[model samples]
Target: MKLKTSFIQLPLLFDAQRLLAEINALDASCWRDHPQKFPGNFALPLISVEGDPANDGVAGPMRPTPYLEHCPYLMQVLEKIGAVWGRSRLMKLSGHAEVKPHVDLNYYWRERVRVHVPVVTQPAVRFICGDEEVNMKAGECWLFDTWRMHRVINDAAAERIHLVADTVGSERFWNTVDRGRDPFAGSVTENWHPETFSGLASPSPPRLTYESVNFPDVMTPWELREHLLFLLDDTRPHEQLARVRQIASRFITVWQEIWAAHGDAPHAWPIYREKLDAFEQQIHRFAGELKFNSNMSFIEGMNGLIFIGALGDRRQPTATQGMRRAS
Candidate 1:
């Protein structure tokens, strides 16, 4: 489901002191690794493949990292979240650092949500998704729509740490969301505290001249593109696409034979696919000798030469012809 705000406050909270105690126990080395996706930033793994939080792609059989040992309470809270999780980690935004705004584009993110539980924060640390911004406070449980362009800034004097987890939502997760409040609708601003919250996009002006075909009437074109690329993925496995590819392959086969007849398909169905296959070997032999791009282009040119001439002879009747015959 599309979220109502830039961030959603799930109906769960942790003890600030206890969460902070475990967070403070963590050493500097855990956050030292170069981030895989968020380059030049810092993160530490809690539950992830090979215990590397930076390895953001993997979503199978994740286990707890050594750092998670310190926060049994945090793990307990995670268990209560009810999501079949992928990764959980601690992300530290050092003072004066800024996480550049970007949208996540990957298969893993299409159906998954990222949960942020702040363990350490200050007023100057701002979390911005699209246009609206807020300072996520310590011990607050929040979820943001990563499908949108979002980023973070630590203008405070100290590092800001957030316990973040990635998960494909569960029934329990949605239940919490249903019960959760809409903070944005209530006018929560940059001064947003633990006090209230939801629209990551509502109340904001809509961008039309735009068409959204994906999730119905609401999304703009850019949002739909992001949804298709990352969420829906490629058009592979589509029946029409499969048929198109098949025709493309057959066109190449039909062309090579047409060329051998010296640009003349004197016979109606005038191309032996077997002969075309053999001729393709010579095209491969002098691959670099072409005036145009590649042997592929040469094949395309052959198809172009044969295209109009190849049709019309003994052509099958259309539905119109069938209707006329019946009449």
Candidate 2:
């Protein structure tokens, strides 16, 4: 409802003409060519532009570019938020395109608050933050705790553009973020010890197994698919397939590790192998059903081939042929 913090307006304003020019110059074709990056039925690539405010080696996640570079209006707005938080890049979403509801997990949760300035919008574009729906107007700014559940949707026929920026938090908030840091770098395994595996030493216990995990009652299948598409869109099909394989591979590794630690029972190896086999077959079946014809399709095929090679079953042809076919 009420965002954790109140939003303040910045003095900087962007040249709409320049902003439109830049958006037009971008290679929208790249996203379309590689459908795998952005998948699902509704997720479509409108445009993406990059700018460097911190001049860090990596491009920060997508946001408006014009406002970040030269919008004096935005800079003044950030000044009100506090001195520590500076203006980051801004990203504009065109047409009725909308970003799925997601938490800013990578950043902003600690002490940073996200600010949104609606540069151009129609009534159909709604910004949902928690339970509150805010209809932004041109030149108006709002500071919100984006760490909570939030999403933007454009149901309007016209394009909706907003200047999204990130600012630093108060000293107390920064301290909380610092305290939550992972002491063992980014890997949870580093903190794991032999004693942590003690629970697996006991005989295998029955656990719930299902073909798929359903979404919570609050979300319908279409809504869930929309959210997934937002995540999947932007990569080639092969990339999506690779990502899926990577997840499966990690699961297999964990299973192997458990078996190594406590697989003395007669049923352990057979059961584990059977589960892996079933998973592999299921993924292959999904790949076949995707009807991949675009680059995304080819990528998915490559992932399937990789799985086939990794399993080293005689039924699958050699990696050489698989590679040839994928190419």
Candidate 3:
């Protein structure tokens, strides 16, 4: 189902008072630098890698931290959020701090939807997603598409704390959403899955120069493709996948049209080819980086998947294989 709004409030609610007391009991010093830098605060990892939380900077296997084991109350609350939670943590932002506007661009982002359960918040704290904004209160559970431009700003005099967890939407989670507003209901469009690519005409050979363009309003085409696939991976029911598949198919097929124009206009294609190659390379490098984060196999599977295969030759080496081989 297409999302009806920018944010969706889950049907469940929690005891804000108990959650706050439990969060406060955890050792504040344990929080370390969040990879996002988060404007200017640390994160208390509830779930993450097996190694030292001080060292790990990204997502990995669903490892439970010492802190998680310590707070039975908080642990019970996380369990209520969903059945499968990955790379979760208690994020704390200092008063008056703010996270810069950005999108989560990796394969993990495409595969997970982050759920927020606020433990401590005030009216001054605000979250902005695309054109809309909300002041999420304590004990509230909310979610938004992270692939879109979103950020948080805590203007309150006190710190802002939240229980942030990721999930590949399960029946329970979708049930919660369906109870209120269904976000994943839609049929795939035909144009999104292009006509077969069997006998397309060949274009003339051309010189190549690499250059990139910047767009301030949203993510580039490459980002959108990954995001689309991620959404497809997380969503439930087989039919919803078709809508994402069609959109992805259209995106890559359009590039083929531009690539075929190289015979008539060689100069621009070479430059664009360079940029596209660089973007594909970046995807590989990112996949390699996630190897230690316990995401090596997850990313590897994406290559064989139909959604990414829509790009035809434009697709890069699967993140796990070629990039790791290069390293």
Candidate 4:
């Protein structure tokens, strides 16, 4: 999610010792290579689709994997965050490894915020986002603007591990963020009190909530308009932007008319598909050369945010056909 600042330091801390212990208890085989096969990068799924650690797809009823069930404090840590989780994992970057800079362009991440809790990290580990860089200390909770170009680098010889969780964020979560500190801000919150999780606390299974409806069969006209406006706002000024806007306006008007007539009835899917296809064709005619300030193709963002899952079978979980990894 976009943020006013590049990074926000939430007022929360965890027991790094206990967090590391739980991670260490997991078998070496539990860690899987990065899906894109980035060298020296691996992730152990904590929360995944149907609790299957091997499943990386973001759409579905998320569940706590066996790995998460084994870590009592880890559950407590997430419970304290107060958000319905999507796809979460323990992201590990080995020494000298770096997460290449890229904006999270996936539809799933359009509204979701990625939370980072540095479990095992050194001062040399630098998280670079846009023009700012910060060394998130062990046990610190943070949220960064995933919409901006970001990457992580570990200069130390030791591996760096962080609990990376994704959520749309809840009221409680945002309330905490309201009190959070932006690193770029000149003044610090000297009296800020962070809730600390201690290992000595009694263990109790946390009743965590997971996301079920990530994407819909048909994108609502309101949502489609929002995505279009956001993309247009982010797009670099171009001669064709006015034409693209007009095309998008017409599409939304037609979409609203169809929605008013058919709502979400199964019979209306074909009609929706036809309109979406026409809209894409018309927009790309002029928007093909348009690009966002971040260097992402405008049409690519359009497909990911508004087109791919805009028309599908609502009776079943949405398919992950064109969904890109949010890396």
C-alpha lDDT score of every prediction, in listed order: 0.52, 0.39, 0.54, 0.85
User: What lDDT tens digits, residue by residue, belong to model 3 across residues 74-151?
Assistant: 666655555476667777788998876655544444455778888788999988876778887777677875645577
Better of 1 and 3 by TM-score: 3
Pairs that collide in candidate 3 are 1-183, 1-184, 1-185, 60-293, 110-230, 188-243, 192-246
The parts of candidate 3 lying over 4 Å away from their true place are: 1-4, 36-39, 55-59, 181-327
Tell me the tens digit of each residue's lDDT in model 4 across 139-196: 9999999888888989999999999999998999899889899877765666677777
lDDT of 3 at 301: 36
Error of 1 at 55 (Å): 4.4
Where is model 4 poorest over a 10-residue stretch in terms of lDDT?
315-324
- Over 4 Å off in model 4, which ranges? 188-190, 313-327
Candidate 3, position 175, lDDT: 82
Per-candidate clash tally: 12, 31, 7, 0
lDDT of 2 by residue, 256-322 (tens): 5645665534445455446556655766554443323222242343343232322222222221232
TM-score of 2: 0.36
Compared to the true structure, candidate 4 yields what TM-score? 0.94
Q: What tens-digit string does per-residue lDDT give for candidate 1 at 1-327?
A: 135577787666666677777777777676754333344356777776655544542424566667876666666667656666666677777788778765543333445678888888899988887577877777778888664567788887787778878777668878887665555767543444442221122343222111111111112223323432322122223334333334435544445445545443435243433343344443334322322211123223222222211232322312111110000
Worst 10 residues of 1 by lDDT: 318-327
TM-score of 1: 0.56
Task: Please estimate how well model 3 matches the true structure, expressed as its whole-model Cα lDDT.
Answer: 0.54
